[model samples]
Target: MGDYFIKALACGDSLRVITTVTTETVREAQTRHRTWPTATAALGRTLTATMMMAAQQKGDEKITVTIQGGGPIGAIVADANTSGQVRGYVTNPEVHFDLNAQGKLDVARAVGNAGFLSVVKDLGLRENFTGRVPIISGELGDDFTYYFARSEQVPSAVGVGVLVNPDESVKAAGGFIIQVLPGADDAVIEKLENRLKEIPPISKLIDAGHSPEQLLDDLFADHDYRVLQKHSAEFYCDCSKEKFGDSIAGLGTKEIQAMIDEDGGAEVTCQFCETHYQFTADELKALMH
Candidate 1:
């Protein structure tokens, strides 16, 4: 209802599916970024896809997805943890365009298709896992699907969508990822491909009040499936003034003194949430020591 995701195993455990509804989460992002309709759709789709990808990890694991399509919307970045906390922002949030030929938001127009989609995974290891693929459609869903097939070598179908209201606010946002497992047969894969074509757009389904379980049912079509887990999703940023101060301190005493003498204060704004953190002259002085 609010914002949640489910992990499920379907088709006799030969397929893995993750479905999520992200309307409220995307609304929060739109409000924080003041994104236009087209920009909202682009960023919302990226955030939804990033959350679903992170859901595949374990505790404390994280995923960062970045898309640079050389479009009017500029770069899109999203970070998500296994716990379902996600935060993201677009470099240009005021972009908008007329609907595409399909009578839907022109996401590809805003996102462009001249760049790349990259994913970085932090698994609490010395080196993070990084995968990148060329941007296919700039519609986000197909781009991510390509990432799985090319980068991860897992045949996957990704369906992500976002619908904005007349007032430029998020009306609905959601997505699903269906992956063919090791044991899946060609018949199962072919059936899934056909079914994906028949189902409505994910945003439409979410707007029509389709739950995650119901979404899986629609994909599976009477096939048996088991729900593995349910997790609530949210837009959360862990930035703080203290953390920013620590970063500034790492700049060393000379830089701190320069800020104290030249500006008397410093204001740092987070890219993800746009929250401003201020440090007074005295605070900078303390960091200098």
Candidate 2:
């Protein structure tokens, strides 16, 4: 189907699982960023995982995820809201490499083995929540799991994946995050760990046309879980000319004057969605006031 995710409570409500299918969203991102295969996989996985984390909040709360490895891809950035609005970009989208040993995208090499994954959550509170963790694997899913356990103190399992076509189109993109609560028993954790191992890569399932709901069913077929909510996700960027104009005004009167006198205009392209906003010399002059 389109992009969507299901949040569920399993193992007698002692575990939380979020399964998301983001094929369409990933495809849109590749188109906007013109990402190569490895770059697409790296950025797509980050986007999917960030979307799942954003679903943890409510109202106007938002989440921003930054993956800044020392690789050629530079940084992968994504921001999402509880309502499923998401926008992201890779600093270098043209990086590519041969497949890994498993004949899979070499995301780790493209995203690098060094650096940190930082997540900031704007919970509409006086102080936002920020979590930082070392990058165990540039595969992204494992790194997120580590972040939850070590940084956020939540024992979680994240399994994000993305597949690309020969033409660099996004074939599939999806993932799941499972967290054990304090009440979780050893048996419950063991069962989940075993199930996770037996399950195929999340991207494979998505390529096989599995929906988020179906994925949950397959993963926890024996467990009695309740669906908490479902969110429709999409590639949405709300950038505008006025927003960029205001930013230009914030650059002070001299800078605005420089754009008017030297360049005769100002053109700002959004890094997230690549939306271009152009202001004529007259418009730049107007902002001087």
Candidate 3:
């Protein structure tokens, strides 16, 4: 199935939920960064969570999520907009580790336990909104849940998972976010919590051929959830050769001349999607004029 995300309301509008299937997205990331199993899990989880958060915005608003954990994987950054576009990268993508004690990918070790998860929302205002919280757990899902409760002051549950193949490719990747809005009764919260604990991991559910709507049904069970909207999600990058060329032009005349004298040419590569742009000597000369 194509990558997609869904938003729904349950418990009489007292709860908001988002879910996404991102297997293809994660695969594209792995191919671009050549990430190992552990790195794939870490980056994939962050991308999945960012996509869900972006769905909360309106119009051209966008959200950028940055996880700077002092671990082998370095920093993980992802940006997603209301249009369902997402792009991200890891500072160090070659990091890998054996399964943890639970026989699961060792994401905590790859991401470390000390750091911060910061979200910056560009709402087309003079000052954008920003929220930050300490990383309570390097597993990512718990860290995001903590962000919601502490930073946003909303009780929420986030489940993100990525399964890597034996050859270090992505097998399955997806996630879900369920938040309790104001006036949520204790009984409703308890039922939702219980269901969350009983349900399988999000990645496993997607691998088992479950759709985003079905995942919500499993989370809400007998409760009625009204689907609000659905949108296709993918690993999309907005970088282009023309944009890089403009950046080169902005480097000023002196820097452009230095490039001609030293390197004979210039090459720019985007770290987000790994797209490379090369400028030959003739191209550089034209820019100099």
Using all chains and alpha carbons, the TM-scores for the candidates as numbered come to: 0.98, 0.98, 0.97
| Candidate 1 backbone clash number | 0
Number of the top lDDT candidate: 1
TM-score of 3: 0.97
What is the per-residue lDDT of model 2 for residues 73-117, given as tens digits with 9 covering 90 to 100? 999999999987788999999999999999999999988868999
Tens digits of lDDT, candidate 1, 1-289? 4799999998889999999999999999999999999999999999999999999999899999999999999999999999989999999999999888999999999999999999999999999999999999999999999999999999999999999999988989999999999979888888888888898999999899888877887888885799999999999999998999889999999988889889998999999999998889988888875
lDDT of each: 0.93, 0.92, 0.91
RMSD of each: 1.0, 1.0, 1.2
Clashes of each: 0, 0, 0
Weakest lDDT window of 10 consecutive positions for candidate 2: 216-225
The sequence of per-residue lDDT tens digits that candidate 3 reaches over residues 1-289 is 5899999999888899998899999999999999999999999999999999998889999999999878889999999998777889999999998899999999999998788999999999999999988887799999999999999999999999999999988999999999998889999999898898899888889889888888888888885789999999999999998888888888888999899889989989998999889998788777763
In candidate 3, which residue pairs get closer than 3 Å at backbone N, Cα or C atoms, i.e. clash? none
Measured with C-alpha atoms, the lDDT of residue 11 in candidate 3 is 86
Better-scoring candidate (lDDT), 2 or 3: 2
lDDT of 1: 0.93
Candidate 1 Cα outliers beyond 4 Å, as residue runs: none
